[model samples]
Target: MRRGYWLILVATILLVTGYHLRFQAPATITAEQGTANLGNWDFTHQGPVSLSGDWLFFPGQLHTPASFLQTLQTTGGAGRAPQTLPVPATWNKLYRHQSSHPLAQGRGYGTYALKLTGTGHSSLGLVQQPACTSSRSYFFPASAPSSQPVSTLGHVAATAPQSLPHQQPVFSALRTRPGAPHYLLVQVANFDHRLGGLCRAVYLGTQQQLFDLQLQRLIGQGLTIAIIFSMTIYAFAIYFYTPHNRSSLWLGLWALCATLYFWTRANFWEQAFGTGGTFGFAFHYTVEYCSLLLMGPFIIYFHHHAYRTRYVAERLLRGNFAAVLLLCLAVLVTPVEWFTRYYTPLMWLMLAQLLLAGYILLRALHDRQKNAVRLGISALPLFFTIPVDLFANLNGKPSGSYTELAMVFFVFMQGLVQGRRLGLVIVRSQHLSDSLAEEVKHQTASLEEKNYELLIARTALEEANRDLKALSITDGLTGAYNRLYFDRQFLIEWQRARRERCPLSLVLVDIDHFKALNDNHGHLAGDQGLKAIVSHLHAIFRRASDVVCRYGGEEFVVLLPNTSPDQAAAAAEELRALVASTPLHYHDQEIYYTVSIGVGGLPAPGPSQQPLDLLSAADRALYQVKRDGRNGVGVADVIAADIRA
Candidate 1:
């Protein structure tokens, strides 16, 4: 594993080295020599010289370079002398002789004059400083000895060269013959009120060399963009797989902010999308402010995960996020001028944040947390680069995106730490899984034993349920089905008869003088008689489809499926005779009873035919037997007519 990590580190180093070499700038001289004898300087190998040093500075406005030179000669004996401010510096810092908090002093215009004698090149490249809202340069020679036309001297406007008249010469390009002294006047306006005017070195190089420098800057920015973009993608993927790791998510957002910061500063937005004016201005500052503000929380959260802290890191992380969010809102709504003024302080605040993060990392290192030392080692570049850039800008020196490279390197190292952590988690999980498998096997055997016992209990419960259901339908006294069972069976038989297209018969039998027998022979004798009749009923309803049930007190009902009315009436007569002849021997006494039987039948039940209706007809027939004479079989009128047929 250690070897793998080393291999990865070596590969990354090689890749970055290759990218740097691929887009490397052409070899050129620093040209930091003093402002004298520029004509003797070589234009090819020692390309552009840093035009840094003392220059004649005129605040407010001086149109023509001749006017600026006149102001310089007199030295203003009675009035204020021309303030000798340094070139390649913001007027905000240099104008009042106060060097700090230049933006708070605010907006103005200035003209800087420098004398030079150089041989004519293809062109003189004029690079505008970032803070200069608008600028124009006027070129002059020792004598009017040039092929290019020189316009009549007039008030030199501070507008761009594109807006100037064609006759007048501008500093977009300065053509000259050898051995001629050239005086250059550059006019700059500070509309933004902060970091105003050229703070970077001016270069005088061949057109081809200047173009190569521009290309090199672009290629380097592109490479940084690709590097940061990949880091963002990797962070997001890690967050997606492990949502609990908030550090990964914050790192992704931080990487995204870094990309946007470079994009805005590198002027890629204008080149790709043509986004200019107020929207572009707003977008650039918003991105810049957010990128700076977000760095604090990202570092804190990363430390919270990568190392151990005393819960203070969590609070810091939350506070940092809230502060960044508020700053984002301020950057969006506040005017660019106001924001630019505060940008320096905000940068200082960021430097302080960097220190705080470093303090937390140092604590982690003290505690010897996993990967703490490696992570600190990786972030060393960022710690140095960020302050370097901040101080460079404060001192009015150009510090290209060295901080961006530092951030990429830091994120790459964090990613490696995360990968190592994930690897450890996977190994531990595999070990736990093996233990869990054994536990599951034991639980499975125990569960099977319990399940077998449950199956036996379930079977016994089903049988008990069936016996209880039978008891619910059975009559308690006579061991016959009660009226409730009769009603249910009547419907079943009626439907079955209809389906089979056969007649269904119902015979209602009532014991004659049953109430009198109950009064004289006592209820016990009556119950014995009922049991005797039930035994005869069971014999009569021998067929599986036939049902016998006690309709009510002293009332018995028999259901004969697929039986005609004639057959039903005949069966009822036999039941009546059986009751009259069979004697119930109770307490050494023989008791005889007769029954009045009624028969009702439906020839293939229909929709109009009902089970209750059929039972009612049978009841009416029994009433007729009671009305005429007791102990006789009676058939319904419809069944009697069918039997006659």
Candidate 2:
């Protein structure tokens, strides 16, 4: 069964991966020797083409379109010749004259120029998405009369301060004349991040095709984020409503952090809120670092709760959380350049976290812990993807949708595990309820026989009779006093209250929408909900003289000695609020419920009045509360036969 389940999960992952790959635009032609000849290419048929391969690279120079054109014309291939470097690669990887050392460091600025030849006169669109710290591109069309670029993205400067970094994607339309070469110049500056120059692919297509592609990418990212956020909400709901499950809380926090991290990476904010300035840039990196750092600790915390290696896991969790806090603090206080230099260290830290997680999982498996295999199955995707993502980040490459898809699969598996656990709990509860009912019946008969033979019974028999009597009067499921006990106790309390000239109160509580809960969530859930409400009743009315009883299904009665009608009403309101606020969690599902409380008391009972009158009065008030909408407290003074809310 387990092997079959795993096979199904793997198949689902492959299906999702295939769906993600379907949207990717494939490149057919590669630019060589600083120029791409597209004479044989058809833009309408090919969709979009990637401008990847050798491009003219001018190290340490930030050149404009007009200046570069003038320089090339004036120099006429003189001493200041440009080198051919691969597009979609950082300048830090560029070597000088067969030397091992790089030609330029990551901190410097540079210009990249690409020439397009043999393209027929057709209106075209260019898309550039640079993953470096910052960049600006100028598109000079062949049909233009002047040296000025027809379209420009931001303003690239020689110095860091003068540069306005364009982190968002840029799209430009070109009107190309027949039999002319077009010049595309991109100037990049990187004073902050670890990689400079064109790190992402540039594409060319028709204007509408590029726009449609961009829209599709945005929609895909938006849908993925939406699914992650929904899972976050579900995890949080379980954490808050369930009795004890800190794992869900950490899981929710981790999902939230992952969502925010991906959102910024996708540059969705730029589309929604427009171009990000200096503040936006800083905010982006800050959120990125904080979210990434926090995710590790959050996952560790989640694993700590899911599996028990607490002593070691607890120490690890504390250290990781503290380190994350310090790193986040550094990101907030220091300049982007100063903090970004520690990217290698951050990567190492993340790697360590991954190793620690592996250790924990191994330890759990060695110990033969419950649900260990299931957890391993769920975590398989993350274990595979995190390393791949880390490698991509290290190499300045764009990460794929593997991590997102993995998270989706992980959440699905978690839901399945939780559902199975809930099923087990329900089955166990039903079995226990059945066994307890049979035990109670047998004990009741024994108690009756022992009472008749008390003279013949020994001391042990007397004690057993007492234990059986106690069990007979108490509810099997909720452990509250039963209705029979309440009936006899209520009369005794009423007579004593009348003799002592003191008030005696009765608070009747009923669970609202109980039948609906049972119908929707099943009888097992209803049984658990009943027990939860009874627990609240016992907690609130805990005086030694007070008696809590399960009057019937989804209805409970509290006998408060020396409590007035007003006092009982206040207590009932407190109980009502408590029950309404605390939801019953069955696995991933949170079931919220409320109670209608009816308070009835005799402040000074007349000689003619009976105990049944008080019960009748409380029932009437309960009816009134139900009629006036449930989840509220209503009061009735039996002496005056008046009811109030």
lDDT of each: 0.68, 0.77
State model 1's lDDT.
0.68
Model 1's C-alpha root-mean-square deviation from the true structure amounts to: 20.4
Off by over 4 Å in 1: 1-36, 65-83, 95-106, 120-124, 140-174, 308-310, 313-316, 400-402, 422-645
Quote each prediction's TM-score.
Answer: 0.58, 0.66
lDDT of 1 at 425: 62
Give a tens-digit lDDT track for model 1, residues 301-393. 666665545536457667777887788788788876688778678888888778877887888888887677878987899899989998876
